[model samples]
Target: MKESEFIKKNSVFWRKLKKELKRSGPLTCRDTFPDDYEKVCYQIGLSRQRGYNLELIDSLDSLALRMRQELYRKPSLSLHNLLYQFLVETPRVIRGNFSYVLAALFLFTLPAIATYFILLKQPHLAFVLIDPANIEHIEDMYRDNAPHLGAPADVDSRVMMFGYYIKNNIGIDFSCFAGGILVGIGSIFFLVFNGFFLGTIFGHLENQGLGYNLSLFVVSHAPMELMALVFSGAAGMKMGFSFLIPGPYTRLHSLRKSSLIGVKFLILAAIMTFVAAAIEAYWSSLPHLDMQSRVIFSLSNVLLIGAYVGLLGWKRGPI
Candidate 1:
């Protein structure tokens, strides 16, 4: 295309970009900035090749530079940035995949309910999913007067358990996300398996008169850990959905785009999982935290998380 025609074709886009760059959180879609940046760079090259005027070349080059900085500059790790990421960006990303979240919730909750009722009717059925040895261990761990719950009494043991919790939690989260590669079936399986497993444990505990003890131990961390799994399951389903449908783009491109979005979902999942692991290893197992205190803390966390995700996510933040 002639330089004049090319300029005419893209001037509107450039103007929009300029406007967006002036906005507080510039870049309408941060991920899409690369495509826009590359296009601008290509335009600069084309103008130079066509022997366009120096004024126009310089103008395009300047715009390209602005875009490049936006695309590649290291974001500051300021408090404001962190707050915005957690309060605004993370929730926005999650809400965008709300349908997938609903799907994940359905898969998880339904199985849990089913298994819980089934195990209540015949507690022995818990052995189907949980090993007999593990059931015995769980019974001892949640005994009414148990000293440490699942945690050990020593500081070193607690530290080791902290690390182990993080490792184990993250591993589960990664599995929830990576399972999308099996066309979402793997993700579904994992969610159902976990939900059923939990129900099995809960049912068996209640049967053994350890329900209150079990709740006291898990309440502090359950909200965050469950949220993390839900996020990861949604992320997995999203990737699988994109690959399965591919709408307008090629299968590969669709997969690539969804996977990028999935990575953001996993970011939230990882943050929640890490928090849950910390609480489980330390706060949940703390000997001094009474049942009422644990419930209060857990309730506060749930309210905060729900408000942030439900309220902040639904509305645009100042940042």
Candidate 2:
């Protein structure tokens, strides 16, 4: 097309793009800026190739420069924004996808409940679900008036257990998140298996008359750890669902779309697991605290977590 014709055809788009770049605040969708910048570059090239007047060419060059600056500008990082993303945006994402969260909860808890009751009826089932040596070790750890509930009596052992908890918890979280690639079968399997394992352990402790001790050990961090795992499973399920039902887009496109949300879930789950690990290491392992104190502290932590997630981003305007 002739220079004049080309200019007339795209002048409106160029003007709008420039307006967006010059706006006083950050663009709502920074993702579009690259495309706008590329279009401006193309327009500038065309203007120069078509032998447009010096004035028109210079104007296009100036516009292209502004586009480049805006496109390459580094975003300012602020503590407030970081906190808002962690405390608000993360929970908002979870709330928005509550259906998936509910599904994950059901999948994780149902097997636990069933296994708990089944083991209660048949104590020997614990031998089948968990290794006999491990069961014996766990039973000894929580035996009546055991010096330590779950961790060893020395500081080194406590530190080692802390590291182990972090590694184990995060490993489980990653496994649940990565399992989505298998059309969600892996996620389902891990969730169910974990639930059954936990239930078996719980039932075994109860059968051995160590339920109270086990409860005291786990109560503080169980809420965070269990919920984090559920979130991870939920993320995997979301990715798998995208493949199973691509909706209006191709399967690849749908998976890409779902990944944006799945990643947020994974991040939130990681944060929760870290918190749980810290609590388990420092507070839950303290042998000095009485059972009542531990129970109260655990309940308080659960309540605060619930409030933070339920109310932080409720009905707030768009991010």
Best by TM-score: 2
- Poorest stretch of ten by lDDT in candidate 1: 144-153
- The parts of candidate 2 lying over 4 Å away from their true place are 1-78, 145-147, 150-152
lDDT of 2 by residue, 86-160 (tens): 777888888888888898889999999999899999999899889999999988888866766533478887688
Which lDDT tens digits does candidate 1 get at residues 1-319?
7778877998999998888777766473578888888888888888889899899899888888777777776866889887777778778888787999989988998888888888889987988788899899988888866767744477777788889989998899999999987788878888999999888888889888888889989999999999889889999989998999999999999999998889888988898899898898778888777889999999998997788677874566557
For this target, which candidate reaches the highest lDDT against the unseen true structure? 1
lDDT of each: 0.85, 0.84
lDDT of 2: 0.84
Candidate 2, poorest ten consecutive residues by summed lDDT = 144-153
> What clash count goes with each model?
0, 0
